[model samples]
Target: MYISKKEIEVRYAETDQMGIVYHANYLIWMELGRTALIQEMGFSYADMEKDGIISPVIDIAVSYKKSLHYGETAIVYTWVEAYNGFKTTYGYEIKTPDNETALTGTSSHICVKKENFKPIQFRKYYPEWHKAYEEAKK
Candidate 1:
């Protein structure tokens, strides 16, 4: 599998009252990881949007294992978990500097025509992108 890594410096704003990173912030980190993965694969989500297609999240699953505090750094690992012609699922793992997993999750998305929100096969529009996902998901 092709894994992309992104390092994030936890900020105070991402913490809760108890000074630990809030649970919801991990979802943001997952997005960062996903963007990094796509960029690593030589594709830009912005370009997809310019083409009048949008990939919206259809499902999400996340699990928290450890708490991090402000000033700590976390590394997010992301990869394509599954991809079909109509949908793609990205898997993610957020880890501490020591490589201990703090959270794990998957986000599934489907491409649609931005004008009418009709579902579309990603391969029909972006064959290279679809092939990349197929190759990476192995």
Candidate 2:
């Protein structure tokens, strides 16, 4: 599998009253990880939006194992977990500098026509991107 790693510095704004990172912030980190993976594959989500296609998450699952605090750095490791022409699942792992997993998750998304929100196959609009997912799945 091809994994893309993004290092994020935990900011104070991302934390809660107790100073630990909030749960929802991890979702945002996951988005960054996903975008990093797409960019690494040479595809731009902005261009896809300009093409009138939008990919939205249909489902997500996350597990938090350790608490991260502000001033700490977390590395997000992302990869293609599975892909069909219609839907793609991306897996992620957020780890500390020591490589200990702090969180693990997967997000599944489907391409849709922005105008109608009707589901579309990624292969039809972005064959190279689709093929990259296929290659990464192996």
Candidate 3:
């Protein structure tokens, strides 16, 4: 499996009065991780957009294992969990600099037409992109 990692600094604004990183911040971290993964896969999601393909998250699930505090560096680990004709799933892990896992999550997304916003199957539209995913699937 291919994995991508990115580091991010936890800002004070990310924490609540209790000094714990807000739950929502993990979602942002996941985005960062996903972006890195896409780049590592040799594909610019931005390019996909320019090509008239837009991928939008249909669902996400996150579980917190420990709390994070401001000023700490976070390592976001990401992977392309699964890819199908109609949907793709990305997995993520957010951890501290010391390798302590703080969160685990996954997000599901679908590619659609940019103009009409209609769903598009990978095999039917971008066969090469789908092939790369299939190669990685092995």
Candidate 4:
């Protein structure tokens, strides 16, 4: 599988009262990872939006394994876990500098029309991207 990596610096503002990274921050990091993977695959979400197509997360699941502190760097690895013409599931792993997994998750998304919220067939709408995801999943 082709995995894309993104490095993010943990900011103090992203931490909670106990000085550890808040759980909600993982969602943002996952997005960063997804963006990196899409860019690596030579696709741009902005371009999709321009075409009146919007990809939204239909489901997500995350598991936290370790705590992260401010001033630390987070390494996010992302890949297409599954693609089935209608839905694409992206897998993610957030790791520490030592390469230990801090969080693991998957986010499933579906493409929809911007005008109506109606789901669109991804393969028909973006064959190239669909192919990329299919290949990446393997």
Per-residue alpha-carbon lDDT of model 4 for 1-138, expressed as tens digits? 999999999999999988899999999999999998999899999999999999999999999999888999999999999889999999999999889999999999999999999999999999999888888994
On residues 1-138, what C-alpha lDDT tens digit does candidate 2 reach at each position?
899999999999999999999999999999999999999999999999999999999999999999999999999999999999889999999998788899999999999999999998788778898888889983
Q: Give the residue spans of candidate 4 off by over 4 A.
A: none
Please state the error at residue 28 of candidate 3 in Å: 0.9
lDDT of 1 by residue, 1-138 (tens): 999999999999999988899999999999999999999999999999999999899999999998888999999999999998789999999998888889999999999999999999899899999899999994
Clash count in backbone of candidate 3 = 0
Overall lDDT per candidate, in order of appearance: 0.94, 0.94, 0.87, 0.94
How far residue 86's Cα lies from its native spot in candidate 4, in Å, is: 1.1
Per-candidate TM equals 0.97, 0.97, 0.91, 0.97
How well is each residue in 52-84 modelled by candidate 3, as lDDT tens digits? 989899999998998889989999988878887
TM-score of predicted structure 4: 0.97
Name the lDDT of candidate 3: 0.87
Candidate with more favorable, higher lDDT: 1 or 3? 1
Model 2 misplaced stretches (Cα beyond 4 Å): none
Q: What is candidate 4's CA lDDT for residue 5?
A: 93
